[model samples]
Target: MPFKKYLLTGLMVWLPLAITIWVLLWLVGALDAVFGGLLSVINSVAPVAITVWSEKLRNIPGLGVVLVVSVMLVTGALVSNVAGRWWIRQWDRLFTNIPIVKSIYNSVKKVSDTLFSSNGNAFRTALLVQYPRAGSWTIAFQTGVPGGEVQNHLGADFVSVYVPTTPNPTSGFFLMLPRSDVIELQMSVDEALTYVISMGSVAPSLPAATLQKPKP
Candidate 1:
């Protein structure tokens, strides 16, 4: 029993670190493969001297990640200007005009904009709400208020919330519950996610203000 306890404790210490490193290594490998593929395509048509250089570049590990980051920085700088904005608009128009591509592209674009835009409020607030049935509660995130015909039927008092499942937060139920039913929590979105993913094994500390009592 003692040996089993020690082994389990050791595993608990090492498992998270091992998985984190594995994920990083996989990401680096994927980026390197993309860069290598591009180089291969270039080598096919390039002069002998250039092809030799491309092959050498492909052999360097992590260079692909550096190149990708540099490209992102340059692209961000370009897209901040007027000409770049116009070009982006044209690019969006091109994609949005295509038949089948437009549907997929538009759907993804809308979701990305909602999730990542500074003005958007998706997943900003964590809440405790009764779910599945009465007397049962789960952690949920306030995505925003219900919109369109749904809002018309539900009225202004309801809000859209996402209740994520344990261990896998990507898949979840979307619910439009009355605003009065959800209790807002001071814990941050990241903290709430950690709690959900850990299946309630981890809990965020109470805020300092909550911990301190008002002067008597």
Candidate 2:
């Protein structure tokens, strides 16, 4: 019984840290793959004399990290100026004029906007929504709205949502649900995410106002 108690305590302590490390590892692996692909493209376009040196640099430890940082710095500058954006838009227009590149660039732009844009509406809220069936509710997030004439056709305040799976919240569904059906939680977005990712093991404590309220 004493041994079992110790094991349980140990798990309680290390479980969250273990999960966080796993998530960090997954992000690192994904970024490494993306940056490596970008480097490969750049290398293919480089001249013969520069190609050999670039290959050697690419193989070095932490070289990819340096290249990633350099790219980020350049991007930061680009978005900070009128000329830089003008040049970027010109390049985008050029790509859009091409047959094959147009499709790829457009798709990439759409995905980037969805994932990274603040105003894009993905992962905007943590709410309670009836899912799997009515009378049963689940935690989900607001993704966005149905644009154009779709709202007029549906005749409802509809917003996009993401219903995450247990253990790993990265995988989920993109749904469109009516605004009236969603129960907005008072807890913060980060707190809600923690609760969902922990499979209800961790939750945000009730506010003082709610906790102290007396029953009539």
Q: What is the per-residue lDDT of model 2 for residues 1-216, given as tens digits with 9 covering 90 to 100?
A: 999999999998998799789987776666667767877887889888787876776666555556778999999788779988898889889999999989999999987989798666677678899987999888998877877788787766888788998877889877788899998777878888888888998889997889999978
- Give all TM-scores, in the order shown: 0.91, 0.79
Model 1 lowest lDDT segment of ten: 207-216
Candidate 1: which stretches are off by over 4 Å?
214-216
**Model 2 vs. true fold: TM:** 0.79
Segments in model 2 whose C-alpha atoms lie over 4 Å from true places: 22-59, 212-216
Give per-residue lDDT, candidate 2, residue 12. Answer: 88
Q: lDDT per model, in order?
A: 0.96, 0.82
Query: Model 2 lDDT vs. the true structure?
Result: 0.82
Shift in Å, residue 213, candidate 1: 2.4
Q: Candidate 1 on 23-57: residue-level lDDT in tens? A: 99999999999999999999999999999999899
